[model samples]
Target: MSDDANRHDPAPNLVLGDADGGRLAENIMHFARVLRTAGLPVGPGKVLDAIDAVSQVGVASRRDFYWTLHAVFVNRRDQREVFDQAFHFFWRNPNLLERMMGMLLPAMRGEEAPEDKPELSPRVAEALAGEREPERPQEQEEEEIELDAALSVTDREVLAEKDFEKMTKDELDRARQAIKRMRLPIKPVKTRRYRADPGGRRADLRATLRASARQGGDLIWLKKRSRRRENPPLVVLCDISGSMDRYARMLLHFLHALTNDRDRVHSFLFGTRLTNITRHLRDRDPDAAIDKVTAAVEDWAGGTRIGESLHRFNADWSRRVLSQGPVVLLITDGLDREGAAGLEVEMERLHKSCRRLIWLNPLLRYDGYAPKTAGARAMIPHVDEFRPVHNLDSLAKLADTLSRSESAATGEMVRWKKLAA
Candidate 1:
């Protein structure tokens, strides 16, 4: 291959570091730290590797320097967008740098308000704001008392109600941890099989006779059995389309907790198509699990094909997963890019297959909400429950609803179904 072709090819690896060498090297180290702060997996070894790689390909040409660093740092497809934004901001791209700097300083009275600029990820924004995590010693300082709940009650309450769409970087981090600590308090469903229970109503004649035989028929011992109970299987179909972008990440954390905390839980994320992520979420580490999901899902934050996704689920997955009468959670905003084609039939089929169907919509958080869209109208009538799932309080309420002996749609929600009908 020619030298030019070889120049285009690159190596992988990057790290956070400090430079003792000189100004140029120090700047590069600082840049790598910025990327690390922005949630990239840059490490100490990668930092040394980045420095060595930069030495071979000098920073004379800006384009060459960018690509060299990109080769080392950008490992996954999803990392590209954050890497691009951080590069432009940290390297002082004249346009974005000047614009961002202007905002940091106070606006002069009567200066024309700046037009809304492009959105940056919360992680990127926080990193650029210089919010490095506080350092900790290898050993934590001994405390006489430590509270199980990290935050004060008022602060925790505030965090619980804050909308996921508007939460800051720190708030989001706390929310992710909170979701991991949560337990879905759903009650178990009874099965036809029976297990020995001392207080059971039904007599186990065979067991009683065997016990008496062991006692030489001198005494009769009564044995009892009861229906076996286990947590019902859960099938979660979550929308990851453009409209759901704000809530999807947080909800994914919720799904991950559900998968790890329960057995027979299946998670399917759908954008324009359905993708099973149950296996990925089984990873013990939340960050690693989410990374795998990000790599696997091809249609993140894309268009929605609600009817198409639901149809595929009913046709391919319903019988297999729903045979045990699992409770289904259909989480979406009901904005169908396909205009609700075949949505009603698919929704009805899904509802009938599962023991219970709960439609958890973020939009329902708003007061006086109704099924204004075609897809919502079609789907509302089929679900056994319609509930908002935007905040922690709502999630807690959902747990209570599931733990109850039985539940059905509220009267107000039923009115929506009637109107749609």
Candidate 2:
């Protein structure tokens, strides 16, 4: 008999037999199911890891088992609290699920809790039950809440509430699922090329002679084929400074999707300096691709040196990437702490090299945004377009902007150029 069998309690009808072992396994399966419902990816592999963890630590001690499973499953800071609450509630006792069901019933009935409710859990239960709900003073406030709630409400609402910067380990896993399913529409730009002319103004002498030879020296008309221009290359330079970290990460995910679906899309990341992440992002898996990019980029979340980085890019990579009139995407907040002199020169070089330069600034999400910063002033004049990139709506607008030929003519861009002169 195992050590746990000898110490098994008889008062609560506890026994350590094959049946009890099966029950434990069943509870574990239920635990994994609850975790999955809570937006954690508790797949069979993670379940197996949980089982191994339980065996290694022994399930005789409830606290030890709780922490063991936690170590195996919970990853992010935000997820830890949820997982902890779920774990406690899930494994409370034989009547735990019944208690949770009872708590949920009050929530379903929309009954308000008494003002003098005791304990934090019951208060949480009351709040969850829609008791004393905060009133929105304006229709706009309610609309915004409704919009947020409407986003993937049936799928994973908890994960959606998590900010990209504040995601926990398990929440990050759930976030990846949403990110992987995100569709990025990257349109192709056609470029000029040569082909055999089908109906040229001048006759094709070689083809005419070959056709005559085939027809025993008799004159025979021949048709000619022609080649046409193809799309311009897509070059992306994403900023990874402290201000742009979240936007950059999300954009990288979009770029990864684009790179897989499109051709000739080059991606680079810059914070303190330029790092070519085109090859790294080519990986089939987004997580693996991001891992490779993180490994390659040494200046993540560092101070912004846009001018210096652009200078380096213009000096080393411009000729290679800017050839054939590639369309350039400059994703940054234009909060260059590196001053404006070097940035002005580099921005000018970048503008001259590319067919068109589109600036994507997350700060543009604000209604009253202006190019008042030194960096924004220096770079705005050189860019062909300036666009916002913060939320889903903006990202959708970005796809439309990239597809259309309409140029960016913001008052800020025009005013900045005059001020610089």
Candidate 3:
């Protein structure tokens, strides 16, 4: 057993349920399982630590008990909200079954009581709404069900096209796994630097002489070199504001894949400020990397200051990270709190700094999306490409868009520009 298990508990006789002190430990284990099911990185170790912490601190004060578990389990800022919701639902009442049934079927209690509903995080909501086995009547016999389909679509196809925000827990898990295996087939761009090649148009007198010197100054062979080729640097500027929380979380998985698969990839997160998370994301373990990124970024799920954040990037980081014809992926909803003050100038400067600026907006998932926001209007004209980024299909299309040598002002962007103009 571990040290936690060996340690003596102060609340040895404390019994919240049928069991002795083990009841609390069992409850903590179940909570950890729920968290794992809800996409958290909670493990058995954390559960043990939580039990030990509660035992030492004593759950006399509910607030202290809550924070103790939070300190042990939650390692990232994004996870705090989910943990809070889970704690509220899990420990609200002594009767877990009654509380769950009450929340799930509020209509059964007549219309008198205004439903005391909480705005739960999606992961926590799904976990709390646990599966229920259907009850069968004694008189009923088992029957076979049949379906006649006119058309067919595979689950993978549906999942690829489904919006990230609308995915269930299972589907989201599959999508994360799919994202981990995704690779960007980026084409290499020609550079001024040269490398050794025999079939070169330009003659290399120096290389030819150096090779001939080995053969006693004999001019038996000719040598040549070709310009070096490399994939352009990828600079991602992701938005982590309140409105973008859901989509941003999913995109982080995609970004993690990109960081591991490619080189010269720089990532930045902006809410009210800009944060360079390239180093944090370099960890091979996606869960650990995201945890570190969350701990490092202070302004997540806050208000958006697009203009100010972009201005900061332009002033401090553009020259450092945006050199050598980099392709910039600006992931945002384009909602700015400052009404896009100086946004156009900064956007233009950023556009000029990079070879290609592709703006990925989750709001584009809406059929009636319009660039009515001041930030959108100012930034749209400066970006080379504008695309939807709400699904796996869209991300696949992004890879295609990057591979081809096409005009930046595509049809979708042209129409939007005309409407904004």
Candidate 4:
């Protein structure tokens, strides 16, 4: 429970139906259930709180009533989208329901729906379809295929290609489990610091002198040494703005896995500001770690200020964490609230400070995507690699791609340079 939950009767309550208090409370309780099913953290306590709050506000208007329930149920910013959709569907409005139906029914009818109607999130869609809980999709058994691939198309394969935003509740759970088993292949870089080696090119003159003094003998054996090779420090800068909410949780799982798997990985989450969540991510349990991160970060699913966030990172964190030339993974869609003000300079500075700068943009999943945004254009030219980070396949490919001991592709750089131009 958050501090807000422990407050002295802070105003927020559940209210449903316009008839009577008893019926309104009952319907509101059921609505809370819907929200819980739709991936909200709503519980019995919140329903009670909402009920208590409703008496104070009264059934003034639909807007007031809606807000009263929302305050109690929706604690986190990311949950707002899901809760909003669920509320509209669960309460069952005529015009909105018809629009939702138009958007939902077209696929079954074998035709595309009109673009005018908004589509529902998979979580919201599944929550509303609780006519009966459909059998959870089971993993398909591998079947022999003649196509020269080792594995045929299976649920795992489908999941590998599917966008993180479109996954249902069951699929999301399966995906998280799969991500837990993933390993990011480590790529070590040779540092200037030296360590003792049995057979090496460089002589350890200082060690030999110290050894000779201790032994007090002419028969002094010279020691050999070599530069230490270690996995480069990995620094992740992940965006947590509203535009990125769908991908944020999934990516946090990946970050958590990486942090637990290795050392020297620093993670910072940014939306309107930068937050260092490296310590929180060190927790072994993913859920607990994310909870800690949520508590630490104040700007989750809020407005993006990429330029301002980057500037802050460059000013405050660059020296402390960027030492030893870390490989920086800047994860964002490059949406900036400041419209790219001061972005180019900071990006260039960050690029210079790091050994490699890889920008993982979920927007790259779209085939015809362009750096049309001011922030995207300003930052693109500075990145060593502009890659997609939307699905399991892309993450796996990122692991494989980073593992290779090769320089950045010339054509890739040229293409992005042209795009930025």
Highest-scoring model, lDDT: 3
Q: For residues 73-115, what per-residue lDDT tens digits would candidate 4 score against the true structure? A: 8877777778776765555442433444555675553333433
Q: What's the distance in Å from true for residue 202, model 4? A: 2.8
Worst 10 residues of 3 by lDDT: 1-10
- Give the range of the ten consecutive residues with the poorest summed lDDT in model 1: 9-18
lDDT of 1 by residue, 170-224 (tens): 8888888888888887788899899999999999999999999999999998999
Query: What C-alpha lDDT does candidate 1 achieve relative to the native structure?
Result: 0.79
- Residue clash pairs of candidate 3: none
Q: Score every model by TM-score.
A: 0.74, 0.58, 0.74, 0.82
Candidate 4 accuracy as lDDT: 0.82
The RMSD (Cα, Å) of candidate 2 is 12.0
User: Using alpha carbons, what is the TM-score of model 2?
Assistant: 0.58
Angstrom error of the Cα, residue 61, model 3: value is: 16
lDDT of all the models against the reference?
0.79, 0.69, 0.82, 0.82
- Steric clashes per prediction: 3, 21, 0, 3
Residues 1-421 of candidate 3: C-alpha lDDT, one tens digit per residue = 1122232333322234453454788778878877877777998889889988988997656656767888899886667767776766676556654555566564755542225544455677678766223458576377857786422467789999998877878878888998999998777999988888888777788888888998988565888889889999999999999889889988999999999999999999999999999999999999999889988989988899998999999999998998788999999999998899999999999999998899999999999999998999999898888889999999999998898775745876788898777
What is the Cα-based lDDT of residue 4 in candidate 2? 24
Error of 4 at 362 (Å): 0.3
**Residue lDDT tens for model 2, 269-322:** 998889999999899988899889988988887789899889889989988888
